[model samples]
Target: MKRIRASVIQPLLPDDDVAERHGWTSVEDPFDTELDHEKVFFNEYLTLAMRVDRWVVPGPLLKAHLREAEEKLLEKKSLERLGRKAKADLKVMVLKKLRRQLVPVTKSYDLVWNVNDGVAFFFSHSNKTHELVQELFERTFKLRLLVESPGTAADRRGLVAEEQRAFAALEATSLATMEVAS
Candidate 1:
């Protein structure tokens, strides 16, 4: 219980942002994986890194192992066939066991927040990574974030009513070269 209190109290937080982000992002020397406020703030920039671990098990490999396990169990029990529910249960058990022995793939992303400008940059383009960053950032700061866009940036900078309408009126321009049939 004491360890839990210090070492990132929550592991998974897909729904609850505040409760999940208590210690997951706000930390000094984030490279050490210690999520807490020690030396987090440095000048106008708030920089941190997030590490994600995922276990990827091959479907064919899992299926083969499950088949072997089911056959062994049936043979040991002297049974002709196992029930569907029993097979499903066995598959789950086998998967859990295999998952323990497998190594997890780790991914890390860095975030730089310029508080003065109220702008934060996440150094990745992956949609999946973007979602994770969004969740982590909102939870840590308890402030809503808008995805980066020209309009949003203008709005964030407190654009005047006239500039806002001008920005809204802009249309896409084509850069294609035209052929001159002389």
Candidate 2:
């Protein structure tokens, strides 16, 4: 039986804007193997690196929630002085609980299966699996899959020209008002 392997190279954090700036690209290379070796390797190397580098919590939603929690706690303290120390302690406790619930933000996986053809399949571990896979695909391909075609080059050029004209007009107006009483 022919063997197929699926490997994914994803950023520890979903955003990873620095990676994009550094021209880091994710690519999946599938190869054919004769051995029927079902292997699963879970190395803590990547996770450790991510934790050290602070590349966790790549999504804005999670960050926003954290910020909201902090804001609420601050507001509550500012509004009332009754049992202020206790309130502060409770807030700390709540924050700690939320941190624990915050999922490990950086993770990637590789699945090597002994199968025929290049079709890669896997069981759904969670409802977020599909979304996560799609996110990985976008990062790996560096291509956004949109329903319709985006703006053309000419359109972009036109927009740039309009912006330049607006800027030039503003500059001229500002310069014209300079008083030169000599």
Clashing pairs in 1: 27-36
What does candidate 1's lDDT look like per residue over 18-83, in tens digits?
A: 212323333334335444344345788776766665556689989999999999999999999999
Query: For model 2, what is the C-alpha lDDT against the true structure?
Result: 0.36
User: Model 1, poorest ten-residue lDDT window?
Assistant: 13-22
Q: What would the TM-scores of all predictions be?
A: 0.69, 0.24
| C-alpha root-mean-square deviation, each candidate | 5.9, 17.1
TM-score of 2: 0.24
Q: Model 2, stretches more than 4 Å misplaced?
A: 1-78, 81-117, 142-182
The TM-score of predicted model 1 comes to 0.69
In candidate 2, how many Å is residue 182 off?
99
Poorly placed runs, candidate 1 (over 4 Å): 1-31, 76-87, 175-182
- 1-74: candidate 2 lDDT, tens digit per residue: 11112222232333333322111111121121122322222232111000111233335755566566666866
